[model samples]
Every structure is written in C-alpha cells, then in structure tokens.
Target: MTDTDLEIFAVAPPGLEPALLPEFRALGYKDARYGAGGVTMMGGWADVWRLNLELRGATKVLARIGSFRAMSLAGLDHRADEFPWDETFYSGTTVRVEATCKRSKIYHAGAAIERVERALLKAGMKPSADGEVTLKVRIEQNIVTLSVDTSGESLHKRGHKEAVGKAPMRENLAALFLRQAGYDGAEPVLDPMCGSGTFVIEAAEIAEGLQAGRSRRFAFETLASFDAVDYKALRRAVSVVKGPARFFGSDRDAGTLKGAVANADRAGLSAICDFQCKPLSELKRPDGAAGLVIVNPPYGGRIGDKKQLYALYASLGTAMKTQFSGWRVAIVTSEPGLAQATGLPLSQGPAIPHGGMKVWLFQTPPLK
Candidate 1:
C-alpha cells in the first residue's frame, strides 16, 4: 500500500464505538465508519499522526501495512519474506510480533508468530520481548492482515496523569463518556466524585483545545513514514480555544484532591481546573452557566459498600435536584439499583466493559 492511502484503525473501547465515530467525523473523516471494536478510515501517514495526536477517545491507532492470502505457514513465510517491511520500519528496529489465527489453515498462533519473526529477522529487524514497536498479525480465513501498532502505549496514557486513585477512570474512556453525556467542551463540567481528576482534566483540555498527545511520544515517530517537520507543523496548527467554560472536580478525600491538582497542573490545565475536597452532600452547583455534572462513583466493590452506596447515590441525586437546577448529569456505575436510588429521570446507555465488569452510563437531561 502507498503511504498516502493506508488503512487506519482507531481502536475504541467496546460499546463506545458510537460515541467515538462522531469524533472522527467531526475531524473531517466523513467516511469514518464504526466496526466491531473501533473506527476505520483511509488516510495517509499524516492522518495517522493527526489521529494519534488529536483523537482523545481512541485507545490505539493501527496502520494496516498490507494483507495477503496464505493457505499455509510456508506460504505465509513466502509472502512475509517478499513483503516490503523496510517501507515501515528502519533497519535493525526492534519489534514485537503478536499473531492471532482464526478459521485459517495456519491455526497455530505460535507457529505463525515464529514465521513472521523469522521473516523480520531476515529483513534485518530484531524481534525481542521488549520491542519498542509492535507488529500485529491476524490470520483469519486464509487472509493474513499485517498491521503495525502506531501507538506504542495505550492512548489512555496521555503521559500526564501520573497519580491516579483506586480504579481511576481511563482518559480515553472518560473522553468518550463525556461525549456520551453530550459534552462538547462549550460548557463547564464538574465531577463531584472525581478521583485523580481524569474527567475534569479531560474536559478542561477539550475546552482549551489542547491536543491529546502533546506531551507523549508516539510509535509513529519511529516509523519510516514519519516526517518530523510535518508533525511539528501539525502540532503547531492546533490553536488553543478560549472560552468562558471552566472544569471542576471534588472528592471527599483531601489526599486524592492533591493528586488531582497535580494531574491538572501536569496537563497544563490548572488555570481552568478547580479541585475541591468536599463530600457529595456538599457538592453545590457552580455559580455561572449550568453545564454537565459527570461522575464515576463506586459500585459496591473496593470503593464502598453496596448498601451504603445507595445512600451516596441518593445524596448525589438530592444535591443535583436541589442545588444544580438546569444542569445535566451523568453517572457511571455497575449497578442499576444504585442508579435507581438517585431518583433522577435517567436513561441508560450501552453496557461498557470497565475494570473487569460491565458498567453503564446513566444520564439525565437538564433538571427543572
């Protein structure tokens, strides 16, 4: 495939593909479509870099290098050897090859990995356990699709949130949740039960028009198609958005609030982010244009007891109804009963797999 016409896939958290699709379309990828696990579109290497740098909801950006039909391991080896690996990787680059086989003659994943790694060795690229780049080989129905993980680390690691509380929300997932809650960075956001300030920081960054990957290094930087000058221009082209909206977060634990403050500072969003050490009972609506109250609270696990959490959710509901008139609310939890305790006019979104359990986003329209 030519560098200008590569298939780019942005991996999304399962069940949030709908929320992520619009973000791609919003960025001018009109043909971006939702697949089983993510979104896919055709773009050049520059588009790959831009997606990695700008899209906050994607977990990984993969470039489909090429695909070929191989009926057996020997044929796979032949095709792999003939494929132009030098076009993607520089000579002697360390890479990790992971293979998955389904409905194919080459059913053994280990054997397929061996063949691909052997081909890489012959191509002068070293296959190591701790490789900087990851090459994913998927063999399904005799079609071998070779894709490179252009995002070395998960996009969730925006590289600034160093301190996170127990079961803290992932940034990418938080961004998707915000979008699901109808947040567009035009209004203020408040996370009453914020831990390590993920939602608050993400909302602030969106409001300020900050690039998601501004502080992180990407695997694409090491690829042969990467142009440093073009990337720098892409980074510089993003203009910071100034708005009247502000983001706020509060937690009962002062220690957690400290970390949240530090996280916002590291993200260069301290000016727009405000963290307070307050209980759910004390969460008041900020004095200004009402926006969204997005929260991820405990669900009877290590965070709190199930029985007691009902009261907490009820308190949250009471606070929202009494003090936060005209603002929208979104709560994420694994239990429907907990959400019911809130007594808010809520609608449930798709079940999202988070922290080893299926959780959901429950949202309410602007309260009267």
Candidate 2:
C-alpha cells in the first residue's frame, strides 16, 4: 500500500479463471495473467483502486502488502506486530484477521489468526469481531504472507441491485458469463429465467459502456493510502457511449419481475432493460436482431421437484428450438443430467462453485 508498485490479485470464482483473464488484459493491466485461484499482476495504489472499482468478474481483489517467515507463533507475533500497519490502515480502525495454514510448521490456522489479531491489537488497531476490512494471512512452508481485503463486502455486492431473489447469480459472475457468451455492445441480450434480472441488466450496462464500479464503493476508499483527488479524477475518466441495444428478462414470478425492475431502475438501466412475468414455455422472439439467450433456470434444489426438472429442461429446449433460432444459448445448471435433457447440443465449461453447488455453463451455437 505504498507509492511503490505492488502485486494485485483479482480473485475469480474457481474454474472461471480462464474467463476472467481477457477482462484484465482488456483493462491494460501489466503482466495480467491467470493463476489457480485468480488473476495476478503488478500495480501501485492507483491500480489497486482501479481493480476493486472496475473488475466485473473478480469476487475480491487482494493487495499483497508484504510477507515474512514465521516458523512459530512467537515469530508470527513479532513480525506481524512490527509490520507497518499505520501505512495502510487508518488509526483506530477495526480489522478482522483470517489465516490459512498449509505445509507449514504453524499448522493451526485459528492459533495463527489469534497471534495476528494480537499484533493488530498492540499496534493501536481494534480487533473487530465483525467488520469489513480484514488482514488475511497465508502460511506455507513456514512462510507467512500478509495482505488486506481491499474489497470490503466482496465486489459482487456492487452497492446497487438491492433486491436479490433466491439463489440469484452474483453481478460479477453474470458479467463474466455475458462476456463468455461473446457479448459485446451492439447485440441485444435475453435472460428468460432472469432472477432479479442480473444477466439482462449487466448486459445493458456493458452495451451502454458503463463502468462496473460506477454505482459502487470499495474498501480502499477507507484506507490511509487512498487519495481522494486522484480517485475522483479516475472516476471522471470513464467514457460512455450509449448503444441502441435493449436487454430483455422474463420470469414467471410477478414479485421477482418487480424486484428486477426496481433493481434495474436503481442501476440507471431501466431504460435499456425489459422485464416481464412470463414463463419459458410462453417466451417468444424479442423485437430485435438475433443475440444471445442466457438463462439460469431452476436447478430444483429448493424449488420444484427434481424428477420434473428434466421435463422442464426439455420444454425449454423445445421452446428455444421453435422460437429462438439463429440466437446462441448459454444455460447454467447444477445438474448435468438436467442440462443434457435440454438436448441443445451444448458444450460445458468447468464446474464452478456457486451457492455451495457446482454449476457448469452449458453453451450452444446459434440454433438452426
């Protein structure tokens, strides 16, 4: 968190690393590349600020502040307490400490967390039993690396979209999925099972050339290293070019549709989004050019019968075949069997973690 350039990690949902790498490259991040858990690159405070602000696919952006070797609890305690806490955090700030131990002599993660918390307490910082800012420690082979959670509430919160429906796709993941479907600005987009209209709304934002962080706040804004003037300038630097595209979303639930409308309105995207209380079997061709049709249909865990989900998927596939030809398709489902029931000639990405379930993206070329 100094003026010197440092490492930045854009944490992606597991298995979506490939999907997120191009996004960082497009943003012009230096040495932008994907690793096991996320994308990593080097930057300064400004870059740290930008990633937390702009990245749509990152679940969190962690700034690797510093590291040390801690063979024992006492070693961890001494170095953690002596680390320059004042440089990054505001005085009297409350911080939560989280640690992970692997292949290390200090194998107890909870004990490691206690020692780090103790260090922070003695350094004039309060140990928040609950708070946003966190001091994350990773212990491996007796090496301890310390970093701060620059994204306070996880980037998916986005500050907008207040009314989230049951098992809604996170805005970050929605944005990345849209990108994976090869969605750019000009083409229209549709989400038939649009829970809270995340997919449609995110597509509209991208089409309108909006910054993902436009309506959000980041934890970096609360840090001592933050520069208000420079941040303001960066915010102002976003250029927008409104497109002629309209994004469409529909669901059977009236309450869900209403929530989607309100969420879109809050995000200033109601003008470019359409929401309706209509089931998939009743869907028709939207009044526009062919585009992408992305849906996160009921995975049947908490709603409806799993036995009937196959029939629902079959019906959806038939509906798409009859109504949405020439439009590509992307469906996210926890059940590969249910996805196969679609019979949509689909290809899948790696199963990704979502709401404690592993969901895969089943995609198809435009219908004949």
Candidate 3:
C-alpha cells in the first residue's frame, strides 16, 4: 500500500521453477526470481489480483506490504500500524494473522500476531472470529515482513477432481510438468499413466486457452478498494478455443480411468480429451499425429509396493521405447533410481518440492 511498487512473492513446488518462470514472463513480470518453494516478482495490488486470476502453476501469491527492521515487540507494533490497513481490509471483512520469528527479540509469534491484529482493528477492520483471510508474517534477521495472501486456498484446487485415485498429482504440478515437457498447444499429448487424468485435463484446458482461475474465487476480492471492473474485463477476455491438440489419458486401473472420464466431463473438456483403460505395456502411438507423452507414475514410497513399482517403471520404459517413437517424454518421480530404470536418455529438468518430498522432472528427447 506504499508509493513504492509492491514486492510480490509467489510460491510453488520446487522443481516447477522452469515451467513457472515462463508464466511469470508471459505476464510481463520481468524482475522476478525463484526461491526454495516459490517465486518473487515486483508488482502492485493490481498485479496481485492478476496473478491470482491467471497463473496456472502458482500455489499461493503473497503481496509484500512492507519490510522493516524490528528488534522488539514495540518496534513490531509501530511497523504494523504504519501500514495503511484501512486501504486494504474492509470494516465488514474478517482478517486472520499468522507470524514466524527467527533470531529476533520479538521471537514470540503469538505476540506479533496480536500486535498486527490490534493495528487492523484500530483501522476499523475486525479480526475474523472464525480465523479466515490469513495474513502471513515472517520475521528473520531482525527484519519484519508482512504479506497478504491473495489465494485463500491453494490454486491447485481446480474444483473438478473430487474423487482422486491413489497417489494423485496436484493439478498445479501437473500443468507445470506438462509445460516443462514442451506442450505448447501444438501437438497431441498423452498421459499413459494418468491416474485421475490431471495431466490430460490440464493439457486440454491449456490447449483451449481456458483460464485456470476462472472457476475459482481469490482472496483479493475481499479487499476494500479492489476494482471489480478490471477483474471482470480479464475474465471476459478469456475464451476457449476449438482446435486439434488432442489430449489422451490412460490408466491400467479401469476404475481410475472411469474416474478420469468423469473428472474430464465435469471440467467441460471431455470433447478435447480421450480417457481409457489401457496398461502401459500395451500403449501404442496414436494413428494421426505425433505428440508428447507425460507420466506421473506412482513412486514406490507413496502408493504401491517397491517391487511392483520398479517393474511398472521398467515396463513403462520398454513400452515407450517400442511404441511411442518421435514423441517427447517427461516423467515426474521422487526416486532417481526408478527414473533411471526408465531406460530413456534423460536429462534432469528442475527439482520441485511436492507433498514433503523433493520431486525431479526428468525429460527424454523425442524418439528418432
């Protein structure tokens, strides 16, 4: 809320940096950098709204309100009050505060939240009785920083996949992996190991140019001074295109495939996607056009037994080599050894963090 352009922080699962960087760039955010769990870019309150409405791979977008040196509770209180809370939070709206302290005299996180809440109350806004609209605070190296979260829930909840199968990949991560696999609305795409069809669903959405944030509401809408006109205009400009970039998802589990079909239908993308029950060992190239094959196979620790998982990976590798020629391949796995067993000539892409495990995005060249 200061005269200076706001510093916005966007968080994602780690290895997704490569795929997410392009999305930031496409949004005209040039001065941005990646961090351990997310990306930071320079923008204003408007950018925060745009990001919440547009970014497909981002988990949460935070508006960096301010940062200042604070050594004690008094210093924290003064800094918290200095921010123009009235300009952001409305009198009727509810606000929740959370804090983290490191190596600071005001080490008590509860004390910091109380100070922040007092400041907001003084500006005429009440704290949420139910603890909603969370404001994330971090104090490190004696500097206190405050951020307003724009996405109330994580952006990965696309609201369509209600019945996910075992070891389901998140929609945000699936979109990032597909982009990292070079899916640019050109060729057909295949997710041979697609469990609940997240990858294929995302691919269909992207190919049709549908905005991922359209079906969801962002926390930014709760702000007192938020301009709805711009948001409405942006949404109006988003339209789905009809094209030939077919998306296909298959799984050995027929029940999961049925769930995938239901999910795709619920997403309004059944026309653009094909879901079927097919084992990886029996996967064959589609007859018409070349495409990219992306798979989020179950890593051993998460779902199936280790021996079965290793055999699955090996058989998947063999099937890809024999059947999916001239097609690009990308596999998301936490186990390097399992990825190595794929037998594809792979170079590590990016290291992303998901579900407390470090996931690697590995890519193999298009078959000759």
Off by over 4 Å in 2: 1-4, 237-245
Instruction: Extract clashing residue pairs from model 3.
Output: 14-352, 14-353, 15-351, 15-352
RMSD of each: 1.5, 2.0, 2.3
- The sequence of per-residue lDDT tens digits that candidate 2 reaches over residues 234-270 is 7744443343437899999999899999998887777
- Per-residue lDDT of candidate 3, residues 1-368 (tens digit): 44338888888866565568788888788778887678887777777887887788998998876678988899888887887776677775788888999988888999988998898888877786455577788999898887888888899987677769887899888888888788887788899988888888888888777777877788888886578886677773544444343888888999989999998877778777887798876787777777888888889767777667887888888888888889888888888889889888988865666777788888988876
Estimate TM-scores for all models. 0.97, 0.94, 0.92
TM-score head-to-head 1 vs 3, winner? 1
Q: Per-residue alpha-carbon lDDT of model 1 for 280-353, expressed as tens digits?
A: 87777888999999999999856788998888899899999999889999999999999989999999999999
Report the candidate with higher TM-score, 2 versus 3: 2
Candidate ranking under lDDT, highest first, comes to 1, 2, 3
Runs in model 3 lying further than 4 Å from the true structure: 1-4, 237-245
lDDT of 1: 0.91
Name the best candidate (by lDDT): 1
lDDT winner between 1 and 3, please give it.
1
User: Highest TM-score among the candidates is held by which one?
Assistant: 1
